[model samples]
Every structure is written in structure tokens, then in C-alpha cells.
Target: MYVGGGAGNVGGAAVTLASRAGARVVATARPEDAAEVRHLGAAEVLDYRSPDLGEQLRRAAPGGYHVHLDTSGRGLLADAVDLLAPGGRLVAMTGLGRGAAELPLGRLYTRDASIVGFALSNAATADLAEAAEGAVGALGDTPWRPRIADRLPLSRTAEAHRRMDAGGVRGRLVLTVGAADGR
Candidate 1:
């Protein structure tokens, strides 16, 4: 299960990777992003804004999600724990403005589940290079591709940041350097 499907950066990659690995992928996003999430290989897309989101998720994956990737990190760890299968793992990649969310220690221990935090910044350079190489190799044989919402010139970097900060920017906002002709 992937949280923040609308972001389309980490969440989109999670959907593609999980599906490619033969997992039944489920994602959460705004209603407008449902179709896109499905296109990214989600077997089920739940509207995160719905009041009955928990119930809907339960219905969608009755066996419980074996893995949960939380990209928004907006205090969803507790809920994800409740929806996890025994010995399931939840990885959180981002938290932005959120602070100090409560974790259900009792449930986590009882279910034998685990929550892990990840940050690329802390990765070793060699590991990063290896992962990058693997990603490039995989791209050659897979239908998975990064979605680019907009490509802006380097001069418009501030504008790009503003657009991202305003939310609703799907995929990535690319900043083009130098000339388009590879000069």
C-alpha cells in the first residue's frame, strides 16, 4: 500500500515497483488522482479524503497489506500499523511539516510489525550509485517511467519551487540546465 499517490515521486515509484514485483498494489490519493494512480499500476486506489477511508481500505485488502510505504508521512503510521499484516513493514520516506506523531506501540509489538524511516541523504555514495545503475537498467526492460509534469528553464527555478509548494503538481518539476541541444 502506498500513501500520497498524488505526489507521484516516491509514491508513483512504489506503486510501479510493488506491482512489478507481483504484489497487489493499493494506493491513496485525492479523487482526481485515482485514474493516474491506477495507470501507475495500483490494483486499488482509495480517496484519502473520504470519511470512510479506513473501512474502504479494509474492504479493498481484506488480508491486510504486507507492506506500506508512506510518502506524505502526515501521521499515518498508526493507521498503517492497524492495516498491516503480521510481520508487515512500513517505511516512511517523508514527513514535511508534520511533527511527533503517535505510534501504537502495543499494536505494533502485538502484530509483530515494524516501522522504518528512510532518507536518501543518509545513504552511502556507493550504494546510491549502485541503485541508480539498477534503476537505469530496469527502465530498459520495464514499462515504468517517471512522470514529468513540467520542464522549466533554470532561470525559472523559483517559479518551479513555488508551484511545487502550492501543491497539486503531479510527478516531477524538472529544471533544465544549459541548452536543449546538449550544448
Candidate 2:
């Protein structure tokens, strides 16, 4: 398994989930976050910004990855596809960088590889419920936990957004509903 964007919240969770499922997950993260992503259970964490990212990934799983989950939203499908094994599945959990992209149909078809786009909004209600239930059930046994870097009353929501937009937030900012004056 190859999980891209291992340092982000979703990417981090993917690492934990894939690892807990007994997969040998190789994840991509910022150079500064490599160690932490590894601790999250990635067998190897490569720097996404490296000029030789694809090469490193290939070396990490020389046989090719059976699954590639892209959380980076960096239009990495081409790179991901090149790293896939026969019959591999690519899950695009976020943006493909733009509106359209050309597929390498010949290789894709020949290898029986597939690309799937996933979003909570498009998920079936039952599937969502099942996943929620599974998450609730698995919480106790998993080491994964949502990181809360800051807490502020609902009144400060804009401030939180500003911080996030400015890339100042390292983890989720919890907004607690409270009085208008922010008790």
C-alpha cells in the first residue's frame, strides 16, 4: 500500500488504518514529518518534495503497490499509476489538482488497474453508517487519535479559519459552542 501525504490528518489516519490492517504501507510526508508518520505505522515514509520521490517509492515497494490512496490532492495519479502493480486500485480521496487529466488507458487496461474517486458526500448512507460503527468499535483498540492543537469558542471560528489558511495550524482546531462572548 502507498499512502500519499502522510503528514496531513487524513493521510496520517490512512497510515494507521492500513498498518493496523496488516499491510506494509509506504507513505509520503514532508521531510520534517517522516519520523512521526513512521510512528503512525508506515513501514517507510519518504519526503514528498524530493526530486526522486517516485524512485524512492519504487524502491520501497519494488514489486509495485496493490493500493494507492492519495490524500495530497496534488494530482499524483500519474505517479501513483506508474507505481501500481497489476490489478491495483487507486483511491483519489481529494483533488486531482484540476478539472481533467488524460489517462494512460493502454497501461491501465493492460494491467487491470483502476482509479476510484471517493468523498463522504457521495457515499451511500449505509456505508457511512457502517464505517462510523466500525470506527466507534475500533477506537478502543487503535492508537490513532484526532489531534487537537487548539480550542476556541464558536465565536472565534473565523480566527481558526484564518490560522488554518495561513498554515499556522499543525493539527485540528476544536471550536466549542458557547456564549456569543466566548465563555
Candidate 3:
């Protein structure tokens, strides 16, 4: 299960990659983003704002998800722990940001589940290049692709950053760097 429906490019990429890899991908997003998330390849898209989100997730994947990738880190650690299958793994791709989460250590130990934190920037250049090569190779047959929210000329780079900082952009905001005809 991947959390972050309206979480922009990273969330969209996770859904697409997981689905292309043949995982039964479930995702959470705002109600308005449900359709887009599904189009991105999520098998099920739950409303994160729903009061019964946990129950909905439980019903959707009764056995629980084998893996949960959290991007928002909006105090969902505990819930992720509860919704994991035995030996399931949760990976936080973003920082919790001065927030403290109370984990049920006993449950984690009993279920043999594990939680890990990761950042793509920590990977070696060679590893990143290999992964990029694999992604390019699979592009033809897979549904995975970057979701562009908007494209602006290089002159508007500052505007793009402003929008990003304001959290108004949905996906990626691309800055066209060269001529349209290809320099």
C-alpha cells in the first residue's frame, strides 16, 4: 500500500512502479484525486480523509499489505504498523519532521514486521544509473511514467519554485531548458 494520493510526483511514481512490478497496489489520496491515482495504476484508491480509513484499508486487503510506502509521514506510522501483514515492511521515504510517533514495539516484535527509512539521494551513482537504465528499458511495456503538473519556460523557474513552496502544484513542474526544436 502506498500512502500519498495528492502527494505529487513521488507518490504517483510509487503507484506506477509498484503496479508495473505486479504488486497488488493499494493507495490513499484525497477524494478528488481518486480517479487520477487509479489511472496511475493503483488497484484500489482509498480516501485518506475518510474517518474510517483504517477499516477501509483492512477491508480492501484483508490479509493486509505486504509493503507500505509512506510519503506524507502525517502521523501514519502507527496505522501502517497495524495494517501490515505478518513480516510486512514499512518504508518511510520522507522525514517525520520534528514529530514523534509512538510505535507498538510488542506488535512489531510478535509479527516480525519491520520499519525502515530510505532516501534515493543516499544511493551510489552507479546504482542510480543502473536503476535508471532498467526503468528506461521497461518504459515501453510498463505504465510507469512521470506525471507532469505543468511545463514552464526557463524564465519562469522562479514562479515554479514559488508554486512548489506554496504547495499548490500537484505533480512535477517541468522547466523547459532548451529550444523546442532541440538545440
Best by TM-score: 2
Give candidate 1 misplaced runs (Cα > 4 Å): 1-7, 179-183
RMSD of 1: 2.6
TM-score of 1: 0.86
Per-prediction tally of clashes: 0, 0, 0
Which pairs clash inside model 2? Answer: none
**TM-score to native of every candidate shown:** 0.86, 0.87, 0.82
Q: What is the lDDT, from 0 to 100, of the residue 67 in candidate 2?
A: 93
lDDT computed for candidate 1: 0.78
**Local accuracy by lDDT, each model:** 0.78, 0.83, 0.77
Q: Estimate candidate 3's alpha-carbon lDDT, on a 0 to 1 scale.
A: 0.77
The Cα error of candidate 1 at residue 182, in Å, is 13
lDDT of 1 at 123: 92
Query: Which candidate, 1 or 3, would have the higher TM-score against the true structure?
Result: 1
25-130 in candidate 1: lDDT tens per residue?
A: 8788877878877877788888887889889888988877788887755537788889988888878777756777778999998989888888899999999999
The list of candidate 3 runs beyond 4 A from truth reads 179-183
- RMSD to the true structure for each prediction, in A, is 2.6, 2.3, 3.0
Specify the highest-lDDT model's number.
Answer: 2
